[model samples]
Target: MSYKRVIRFIVFIALCVQAKQMVAQNANTRPNIIYIMSDDHAYQAISAYGYGLNHTPNIDKLAEQGVLFNRAFVTNSICGPSRAVMLTGKHSHVNGFKDNHSTFDGSQQTVAKLLHNNGYTTAVIGKWHLISDPQGFDYWNVVPGQGEYYNPDFIENGVKKRVPGYITNITTDFAINWLDSRDKSKPFFLMYQQKAPHRNWMPEEKYYHLFDSTQFPVPANYFDDYQTRTKAAHEQAMEVARDMHDAYDLKLAFDLPKDQQKGLAGNWQGIYNRLTPEEKKKWEAAYGPSIEAFKKANLSGKELAIWKYQRYMRDYLRCVQSVDDNVGRLMEYLKANGLDKNTIIIYTSDQGFYLGEHGWFDKRFMYEESFRTPLIVKWPGVTNKKIASNSMVQNLDFAETILDMAGLPIPADMQGKSFVPVLKGKKKGDVHEALYYHFYENQEHKVAKHIGVRTDRYKLIYFYENNEWEMYDLKKDKSEMKNVYNDPSYSKVKSMMQKKLMELKKQYNDPVPVVTPQI
Candidate 1:
């Protein structure tokens, strides 16, 4: 061969080797991600939000280190649909998981599949309430259908196994184990989820008596009359005093007579049956005194209501305590493995819950307590110090934000915009001029199906089924007690909100028909 040809060949080989090294370096430097989500965790309960209900020091650390979103919300305030939105970055209707009764379509595109295809190891552990088995993950161990609190069963990679321990602790164990065993050559993403603080709150044995003596103050509107609201508020079956059951919700012993047991006696019994003899003995010992006192008090009227509220708060907060402790465990694991600096940590909930707001315990309405969730994110370089944003972000943005953080191209079909710019302080003020919400479940809580839009200072809602409209001026009526739709002085504001609501509906392709205001 000629000398000139040999020199060209050597240069080509050098260029190829340099390109390969660049690609490898880029892949290694990408940040690992840990997405931790809990079920029905209200923002008011987090001490970082300044509600003063209870202290969550470990979960609060994320807020202390990163950005705390004050106005984060969900597309739909229910479980399955909210998770579906987070996975697909689409509204419930677009994702085809509108409510808990529907099964999640596993064949569709998801953030997990996108990341997994792009050379990242992915896994999800804990509550997988989406009915179908998790798809597109290298590993998944999920609890089936709300899951048990004590000695729960988990479906690990499609195999059912009964693990003997508290559900929160067991779920954390699985997550940490996966992190330990994952292939170390590539960056990883994990969805560490928890099922605590949901309905029928059950705490671990260690926290059984944690809040037994504390007397939590009742909400000011605990006796909400629902007079100025739509009929839906008056008809919901989630009131703490009226709808909550003794055995199922309160965890009192099954001592009531068969006629007065209200068909809820068996629920607690079934959960108690899952515990071993030793565990059951400890549980009964912790709760025995309260059970006896409740029965002897013969409580009636408002006094009885107060008693029930205290019981509910204690159990619910206890469960939250376990979740916080487990979050600390995961944080320690990451720090110990030296992944803390290179990993992005996110803490949020599927959706917000109602902690005695409006005389309610569950979440379904478009009210602030149910619609707004807790969102805290810690990015090593971008958000290393404490800051906050009131940008109207939603769970819809989660998938896009995750993909953006990993330097992957977000699919065009996703309806959510990445908030990374806001997180990096490149953007200021709200990311959206208006936020849209819809709820379709009309079965359990009996909350009427409604669609609404929330702007910076106003909200407009339409109960299409009831042919009713409710408007709230959030600046003056944060609690949403008054309906200003019919007031003439705010006619222009109502009309403006209605127009914005219609625009959102059209943009999102929601098929709900528009109803003219009845004013």
Candidate 2:
């Protein structure tokens, strides 16, 4: 060979080697992501949010070490649809999962798919309530639809098996096991989701009596009359006093008369039967006295309602305590394994729940309690420690933001914008001028179909089916007691918000027809 050709070949080989080294460096430097989400976990219940309803020290550690978002929300407030929005970075209408009844279209592009394609080993363990099997993950072990809190069944990579433990602990066990077994050379994206603090609030045996002695303060609007609001508010069947089942929700069926247990027998029995002999004994020992005392009190009128509220709060908070303890366990595991420094930890919920807000329990409303979700992110080096951001972000942004964090190109068709700039402290202001929300389900809870928009201070909601409108100056009416849509004093503000609402609907390509109520 010629000397000139030999020199050129040497240069080419050197360049190829340099390129391979750079690729390896980039792979190692990219942070591992652990996205932790809980079902029906209200922001008000978290100690970091300052409601002080319960103590969540472990979950609060995320806020202590990173950014706590004050105004994070969901596009849709229901379970399945909200998950779909987070996965696809699109609204329910575009994603084709508008309600609990609709199955998630797994073929569609998702952040998991994007990350998996771009060399991140992905796994999701815990509650996968989206009906269809999860796709685009190297590993997935999910419980079948609204998973049981005790001895839950997990479908691990298409194989179903009953796992013998509390759901929270079991889910964490699977996650930690996967982290141990994963390919350490590649960056990982693990969705360590939990089903604790969900409905039928069942805590692990250790936490069954956690809040039994504590007296939770009732919400100011616990007895909301819904007089000024539209028929939609009055029609909802989620009121704690009226609709919450005694046996199923409060766990009072065992000692109650058969007549009082008529409609609640099946639900309560199904949940109770899930416990083993030892677990059942422990559960009864913790709750048996309370049940007997409640019956003997012969509580009536408002007193009975108050008693029920306390019972509900105790059970619910116990479940939350379990979740917090498990969060601490997961965080310690990450730190012990040397993954903490290079991992991006995100904690959020499917959607917020009502803790007696406006006399309600289940979420489906575009109201503040259900519409807003908790978002706490701990990005090792980028996010500021012990800070709070009021930036208006939604679950719709999750996919795009995750892609951006992985240094991958976001798809042009995705509807949500990446908020990585905010996390990096580059963007100081809000990412969105206005946020849009639409709830399509008119089932279970009987909350009417509604669409709304919320800006910094004002909110405008329209119950299109009833041709009703409700406006709230959230700055003044944070509790949302008064409906001032027709108030003559704020006509100008109402008009402006209405116009913004239409712009958002158009921007989001929402197909729901607008029916402006005549004043």
Score every model by TM-score. 0.95, 0.95
What are the runs in model 1 whose C-alpha is more than 4 Å off?
1-24, 254-263
Q: List candidate 2 stretches off by more than 4 Å.
A: 1-24, 255-264, 516-519
Query: Mind sharing the TM-score for model 2?
Result: 0.95
Against the unseen true structure, what C-alpha lDDT does each candidate score? 0.91, 0.90
- After TM-score superposition, what is the CA distance of residue 92 in candidate 2 from its true location, in Å? 0.2
Please provide, for model 1 over 7-94, each residue's C-alpha lDDT reduced to its tens digit, 9 standing for 90 to 100: 9999999999998776567556999999999999999989999999899999889888899999999999999999999999999989
Cα lDDT tens digits, model 2, 401-500, are: 9999989999988999999988988887888888999999998989999999999998899998998899998999999999999899988988898888
